[model samples]
Target: MLLLASVMAHYTWLAIDNLDDVSLQIQAEQIAENLQLTDGAPTLRLPENLQRAYDQSSGSYLYALIDSKRNILIASEDKARDVFSALSAEQLQRPESYFRLINGDGSGAPYYVLQKTLVGRPDLHVVVAQGHLHSDVYIDTLLTEFASHIGWTLPIILIGTLLFSVWTIRTSLRPIKDLSDRARMIRPETRGLRLPTSEVSDEMLPLIQAINTALDRFEKGFEVQRRFTANAAHELRTPLALLTARLDQLEESATAQQLASDIERMSRLVAQLLLVSRLENTTPNLEPGVDLNVVGETVVALMAPLAIAQNKAIALRRASAPVTVLAMHHQLEDAVRNLIENAISHTPPGTEVDVWIGEDGSLAVRDHGPGVPADLRERIFERFWRGRERSGGAGLGLAIVAETMRAHGGRVSVEDAHDGGAVFTLHLQLDKSAL
Candidate 1:
């Protein structure tokens, strides 16, 4: 736009200058037509209007007549005579009408000179001079005023365009923003849900549809996996019960006792795997609040007999005040029970396994036995993982605890206890505001 404006201004200036030149040519020709060469002394037969204009003595108009010998014959003003006298002989020899611009050196107003050779009088000529400062001032003034207005108008137009561009860009991207927000809400439970396609832009529709299709495949795969695990666990239950009954008939023997223990361990492993499958396929049930202190005390009590049978003791170090957490009762209890069972297994005979419920809603199970090595602490939570030196049970206890914690949006960590034993801590969401 600026380039276009500059081009327009340049052409307009040229047109104005050309028009002024045409006006000067016409004036000089009119002056030449009114000349009379009587007795070889040139005289101007001025019309009433032309005589009045030349004799007006205004700064804008002037006229001078020059003889064949290059001597000034008549001049409307002394300044005109002086300017004509100053022109070189060669400058005065033009065959056609011409105009010249002169600069004022502060002595008088700057002016333009128009000269024309007389038609019949061969050597006679007429020259018309006018003050440009008076005649051409309006044109220069108008151009400057117009250019100044353009200067202000262009910026306003550009700024308005800039603001409109920003609004347009943001408005155009609104659909993508909505798509991102909807994508974040998808979890395993909500995986079957689809993104709304009504308002999606045509340009983005293909990508969004591709993502929805991928999600469909993922949900189907997850359903197949969950069904397989649940069905296999269910099918094994009755046969395992019959096997237990058969083993019970001869369980008084050492071989029968060992078979029973192995069968029980296998049953626990199936239950743990089933729990993992179910937890992964669904969201945690957190409608009813459960107190971690109550859950911890219950799990400690349940594991107390097993600990005592191994010549180990289980104790609950409850918090001073109840620590309420946002978790389902059974799931919370399962997590705490697994931790206690793990502690008791690792603890030696005559040692105590401590279950501590913190006021901040964290549960810690400490065993006074060899602490888990730093490098193996995280690995111990993998399914079917056991320490290098450990034996006698399925290795899903810690893994079950980890999965249960995940279902509750909680965390489980193992660190060295003060007694040089391993301490497993379960960090839960503390519903202090509810309490």
Candidate 2:
């Protein structure tokens, strides 16, 4: 970075040098314009300031007039080969208009040579040479004094610029930094915690919103798990207690039959609640391309006995070809079984329950029972909203199915059966090529 600053300084110095040089050249041009070269008369009469300047200076000015043929018409010191005539003709008629003549006196001598027309002869030329050791000896002394001045000046300017740049960058990023700190301080225990939305940076606002959305989902999951766990423990406890009490009362030949049935029913309800909770928390990572046809076959085989106990017939209708989808095979099969069982439990004896697997990765279950009310259709998918008002099986069966479909980027809904029964539809995101 300092190197970059130096490059900038170099360009700045070039501009200063050019400006100063131009000013010096314009001053010399003005002096040349003012000098008059009259015929047979002296052209330049020195001004008061000029004469005073020459007197105080430790160096003298030498003037000479030379003709076109190289004959010297006039010389400043013609007395006896004075110090001014020391230069050869080649040196006098140099090619360049302005030249610095150095070491003409003794060691360290320097002079500035400017050519002008001689007085009294416009065709004749005169060369005026003046000593210049950096323009003035006194000026050279001031240059050293300014050395220490620049030594402090540049660093002070650099330090100030660096401080300002730091402040600017910090000010621009402060909002995001504060956001990061606040978010970091929050933990899982603080489920309702949120970032300060008002002080958010516009650039980071979308990211913050997305994080808050995720937090909302996490909080919802926490509440559901907490509720489901508490309710499941409470609902299962009484049946288990009854079964234990009934089993304990059974003497040598006494009936223990009711205890066995109660245990079985209680086990089923507990299993259903656990499955619902698992589905609700299922992440996309847990689901994959599982064959729906095979899953359906498995669930149907498992539930046929339960259907028979309810005096209902379980039917599976699927194409001969395989149907595949991205889904949790067991969870999806469990959901379908819940819907089928609920339908079978509600319908009269001998009524057929059909589970159809379509070629489009669609699963539909329909039962010949009184259909659900339109108003309660939405509530049917909600946990614990058993519309005993229609047909009820702990009311969590369809809710679990809906949650499973969501985890797999699929959907589940209830619609009117074409044959006048309640139909549950589960559509999964399937790779159509698998058909």
Candidate 3:
């Protein structure tokens, strides 16, 4: 807009200047036409209107008649006479017709002067000059009005346009933002989750549909994997139970005891596989509040015999007050049981594994063995990711504990124990209703 205004002002100025020049040229030609050669001496004849217009003492218009010898024959005013007399010899010898802008009468006001020689009497020259103060004032007033109008309106127009553009962009992208939020809710346990297509624009629809299709394939593959794990564990349970019965009948030998231990580990692995399948296929109901102290005590009691057999001991340290948390009962108990079993297996023969329940709905299992390495702590809870010190059992125990905590919206972490061992902690959401 500013550029447009500048261009318009420039053209306006040029147009006004051209019009003034033309008017000056026509006036000079009229004065020249009135020049008559009477008795071989040129004389200017002017009409009444032209004579009256130039005769004013302070008029903006003036005219003069001069001869080829640079002598003024007649002038409308003394200022015009002075202007003609002061011209340089070279200026007086200009072409037959010419125009010039000059500061005449030494008054700092500009004049448009047109000089023309008579067609028949070349010896006589007619000069018309108009003062430019009034015209300049008019042009300046016009430009000032235009600039003032634009200055006030342009900023308002720009601010309104900017605000409108922001609103339009945000409104147009609202559906995509909603789609992003919905995509974040998708997980392996959350089946049939897809971005809704109803409000999405056509440009984004194809990408959203493609993502949903990929999720469909992934969910189907995950379902198949879950079914296979569940079925395989179910199929192994009966044979393992029958084999245990048969082995008990021919037991009481060194080789038989080692084989029994191996069978127990395999049974535990099968149970964990079944648990993993169950956890993947469905979300556990964690609305029920369970006492963390009770769960810890029960798991400690169940695993005490195994700890004693391994020449280690297991003990439960209950909280001063009941530490209740939101959880599924069986799932929480199984998670604590895995932690206890893990602690007993890892700790030294003479050391004791402690299951501590905190008043803040937290439970920790500490073992007096080489703590998990700092880099491997997070990976230790991944499915089948046994580190260099792989325990005899399949690496599903810690993974199950992690899955259980995730189902309950809880957290599990392993950190260095103060007494130089590993401490595995479960941080669960406290049940305010139970409190």
Per-residue lDDT for 1-435 in model 2, tens only? 586478556745664444333433443444444455567543454567854654455455555555545455555454211433444455445432455555534555555565544344445555556553444443453344345444457677789889989999999889888888888866543557887778667787788889889889988888877687858766787878777776777774424675566576666667777676565445446444577788789888998998898888989998678777777667777777887777787667888888998878888888887777788788888887877754435667777777777666678878777667788888887765554
Q: Estimate each model's TM-score.
A: 0.64, 0.47, 0.70
User: What is the RMSD, in Å, between candidate 2 and the native fold over all Cα?
Assistant: 14.2
The alpha-carbon root-mean-square deviation between model 1 and the true structure, to one decimal in Å, is: 10.8
Model 3 over residues 1-435: C-alpha lDDT tens digits?
466578667866765656667767878877877777678776777898878767762747878888888788888878787666765556666555444545455665667677776666666678878876566656775566557755567677678878989999999988878888888888766767988988778898899889989999998888888899999999999999988999999949998998898889889989999988877876668865688888887888888999999899888888998887898888888888888888887898999998899898899999998998999998999998877455676889899999899888998999999878899999999999977
Name the candidate that leads on TM-score: 3
Instruction: At residue 125, give the lDDT of candidate 1.
Output: 70
Error of 1 at 166 (Å): 5.6
Q: Summing lDDT over every window of 10 consecutive residues in candidate 2, give the lowest-scoring window.
A: 78-87
Find the 10 residues in a row with the least total lDDT in model 3: 96-105
Runs in model 2 with CA error above 4 Å?
Answer: 1-265, 286-289, 389-392, 432-435
lDDT of 1 by residue, 1-435 (tens): 566578668867875666556656777778777766688766777789877866774656777788656788887777676667765576568865455645333366556776777776657677777675454565775567557755567677778878988999999988888888998888765677888778878888888889889998999888898899888988888888999999877739888888888889879878877777767766677744578777877787788889989999988888888788888788778778888888888888899998888988798889988898889988999977778546565787788788888777888999998758988999989775687
Q: Give lDDT per model, in order.
A: 0.77, 0.67, 0.81
Give Cα distance to truth, residue 121, candidate 3, Å. 35
Query: Comparing 1 and 3 by lDDT, which wins?
Result: 3
Instruction: Please report how far candidate 1 places residue 421 from its true position, in Å.
Output: 2.5
Q: Pick the candidate with the highest lDDT.
A: 3
